[model samples]
Target: MTLAFTCKKCDTRNIYKISRVAYYQGIVICTCSGCQSRHLIADNKGLLDFPEFGRNIEDYMESQGESVQRLVLSNTGVSTQDSSTRLSPDDSGNES
Candidate 1:
């Protein structure tokens, strides 16, 4: 539940708990009036406001052994001149 704001101009990050005004709403301006100058450079958002991406808990449960098999196949493919092995990063922070 950490509330944070990225200065749109300078990219300076700010964190807040509460404010006198309601400027902390989604995609709204930072409390600091000076931040307005950076409006085009950064976005103010709470960490939770960012989109949830990639695999989820269900995917993890399904992928356990299959994912490792993919890696082994990919390693074998890499030895070939043209490997059709293109994989994306997984939720565990490794190549899939």
Candidate 2:
């Protein structure tokens, strides 16, 4: 999975790529490539560390005055804008 967000401190755009395992872990810590600031990206979990910012990529970018663009890409070179395709760790790779 790839995430593109802007740093609040440096205003630099950061692109982060992670594996499916990391994505399903539900917590991602991205380091700003420009200012080297550590940011915590998680879902529903409150602040726990001393990161410069603690929020999902969307919220963080919104706070930084950047519009959120959500896109999902699959291995078959297919892309979609469906947010309901969210995957969980327990997903069995089968459609019900």
Predicted model with the maximum lDDT: 2
lDDT of 1 by residue, 1-96 (tens): 224445546776776443323332333333545454522111234333323311221233344432211222243232222444544334346655
lDDT of 2 by residue, 1-96 (tens): 777777879999998787656554466788999999987775435546534344465666677786766776565333347655555434657776
Q: Please give the lDDT score at residue 87 for candidate 1.
A: 41
TM-score top scorer? 2
In candidate 1, stretches whose alpha carbon ends up further than 4 angstroms from where it belongs are: 19-29, 33-96
lDDT of each model, Cα atoms only?
0.36, 0.67
Kindly state the number of residue pairs that clash in model 1: 3
Q: After superposition, how far is residue 18 of candidate 2 from its true place, in Å?
A: 1.0
- Sliding window of 10 residues with minimal summed lDDT for model 2: 43-52
